[model samples]
Target: MKRVLCLTLALLSFIPAVLRAQEPAAPQEGLNTVMQKASYIIGRQFGADIKSNLPNVDVKALLEGINEAIEGKPSQLTEEQIQATRVELQKVMIAEQMKMAEADKKKGLDFLAENAKKPNVKTTKSGLQYIVEKEGTGAMPKETDDVVCHYKGELIDGTVFDSSYERGEPARFPVNGVIQGWQEALQLMKQGAKWKLFIPSELAYGERGNPAIPPNSVLVFDIELLEVLPPAANK
Candidate 1:
């Protein structure tokens, strides 16, 4: 009985290999097809982000190295080749990402610069600047205020991936507990103040973009300060 059980187990394992080998290669080709499609889609998006900044960049090589690393094939090449490739790939990715970030930063600064030339724009002491295109007299928050706010955040290209507003409730956090841009801009607002904020990548998510925002993405926020709790509110 034990011998029969062992044979059965061995055959079960071999059966799969035998079946896989005997099957037509069409299914494997199909899998490769899907993989290539997915890779191309992702690569294109990445290329767009990189291209906005890098005038002469080889996104394909960078992506191929990244893919190889992800696939655990770093040792596929000779050790020397692996080391060299890794170093070059790292430099390219970092440089490209940095370039993209700088471009986004410049875009934000450009917006500010152009707006500064217009009337009614104001600059605050904390380097928080604003051009109130439209003002809603809803209460705004004081500097020390802890507030509940709803925000819809998007890239300059209008790709919105985040919205506390869409979640059907406000995101409750301290006014001082967010990004530098939010910290600086929110303090300029009062309870119930609704503002359109253009945040430079530097002041926003910076070089390392968040999941919703790509590298070097300048963020736009439609923010509403809902409630400013009292100083002793948390206590």
Candidate 2:
């Protein structure tokens, strides 16, 4: 196979370099000394790569395969067997991920149900909830309008995922282009208003959450509507 030939040539290239290198008279050695160092370096690099990519590797089987390969023995598994093992692993990983998503969805629903009963919390028809911290007298932004706002987003457990306040700058975006929760809430918010929003996962990132957010996560945000930009300004 091409892969086997490539690997063989790579190993063979190291031999000539090791042979050409001069050694001290007292410690005259050949390719064996160089091979020991090369083996250690390769093993260390492979170990690091495996730990980073596959934390739950089978150490015994991995070592056995490496030993057998180094001893020039034929592979114990056929190509078909290797592909089948990989497919099975993928299936198991998917099953575990789905199980976790289901658990998270149930937890989110329970938390939202309890949170809906809190004083000052107002729920919209779309299941968005908010506590008006500071109501504004200015005009509210429409779906087509662009608005500037400062916000701090967090999970139900109070883990802060993002914050415009920390950066000392407000974010600007089209009202309709944001998550369903933001689009619904922004239309109800007037400029200079500050509100604490409790968003269900369905209204937030849904099942496939963003990088910092987990699947089926309940989100909280302290949002301040700074300015509602005119349609011309957006252009």
Candidate 3:
């Protein structure tokens, strides 16, 4: 909430510059000057950010507040009142996010329960589940070893968030450098093994999901373990 206010202040600074340039402000007349057009573009960008973050904001109230602040007029709201309002709004937003995260966590647990019923799916004691698509004869990787693999990752809803195959290149990382689910599975998998992995939110990102993934989202990954090699220091 405070950051949004800061952004609002920064964007409004453009208005004074346009006023200094003697740019006319008449929406009915449309953008006729370069300064006006540029300011409109900046406003549109700010509008996009606000829409994505605070969809329920009152546009009229927002504009009025901005105008008051810019015109050096006394605001209907005192600074203390605005700060208190922001604190309350932040709490509401946090509560809403928690509800969404809990819902996602429940969906993931249900998916894992059904997935474990499949004949090929094996559930570990720690709750990791996977299906071995192809067996490998090579040795498995150690925690410190870096493994090269091709993998495609998706959410439970089949939203593909990442894929090494799409980039036409394999990815390499330490066995223990990944999420808990990947770390555990990689240690049990051998070079040349192909597996379909079902990772619950707890073993995946939990409530702090990646930018590409939603909070508490269950993950699905199709991985081909290509090679396992010691870390650079080992060589």
Candidate 4:
């Protein structure tokens, strides 16, 4: 997930401090030593999650590969053999991911079909569905306009993927620069309007979804349009 990757990157950024701490110094004065020890503890916590995702991974072989690479030593496998293995593994991963995506796509389609029948839900020609929660008397945003809004996004399964509300901040971006569903819906909405948007995968992330969202997943969003600003403001 995106959050996991972000946390990992944040933790990895501390490696420099850890390295610097390895310098000879009095025990009490050694921040780097303290950091290195802390990193190992944190790494084990993160490593457990990584290992869960890679259940079939050979831990010993992986450590050996890392150690050999770091020591500038030849690997037990030849370059050609390694390349072949990597290519094979890539194919396997892709195949498995696609199989999961197909299942998700079916579930998304079924959910959308039933959701469209609900009262007040309007389906657009692009297969985007939305329910206007509040009407605004203010002007509508143009395609090139930048807008400020608060939004909560989730998958069809009701798994929260992202939210500006949770962060206690509103997000601002170009109306045309977002996903197709948001683009269409924003253009139709006036400033101060609130809507519950149901976006099919095609109008959302499609087949290759981002780290937080799975492939072909339908996305739901609760959005409140706060302000429509000039496009130049963002630039």
Candidate with the greatest lDDT versus the true structure: 3
lDDT of 1 by residue, 1-235 (tens): 2333454365456545554555343545433544444445555655565565445767677667767866987545798988897688679868767886777767767776775575665755544456554455555655566788888988767888889989989887776678888888876676667777777666777678886787655677888877778668867
Residue 175's lDDT in candidate 2 = 94
lDDT of 3: 0.88
Residues 47-160, model 3: lDDT tens digits: 888887888989999899768876999989878998999899989999988998899899999999999999999999989999999997887999999999999999988999
**Between which residue pairs do clashes occur in model 4?**
21-32
TM-score: model 4 vs. ground truth: 0.70
Which ten-residue region of model 1 has the weakest summed lDDT? 22-31
lDDT of 4 by residue, 123-201 (tens): 9999999999999779899999999999999997789999999999999888888999999999999999999999999
What is the clash tally of candidate 4? Answer: 1
Q: Candidate 2 — what's its lDDT?
A: 0.85
| CA lDDT, every model vs. true structure | 0.68, 0.85, 0.88, 0.87
Give TM per candidate: 0.60, 0.73, 0.81, 0.70
If the candidates were sorted by their TM-score against the true structure, best first, what order would they fall in?
3, 2, 4, 1
Task: Give one clash count per candidate, in the order shown.
Answer: 8, 0, 0, 1
Give me the displacement of residue 214 in model 3, in angstroms.
Answer: 3.1
Q: Once superposed on the true structure, which residue ranges of model 1 sit more than 4 Å away at CA?
A: 1-77, 118-121, 125-127, 131-144, 214-217
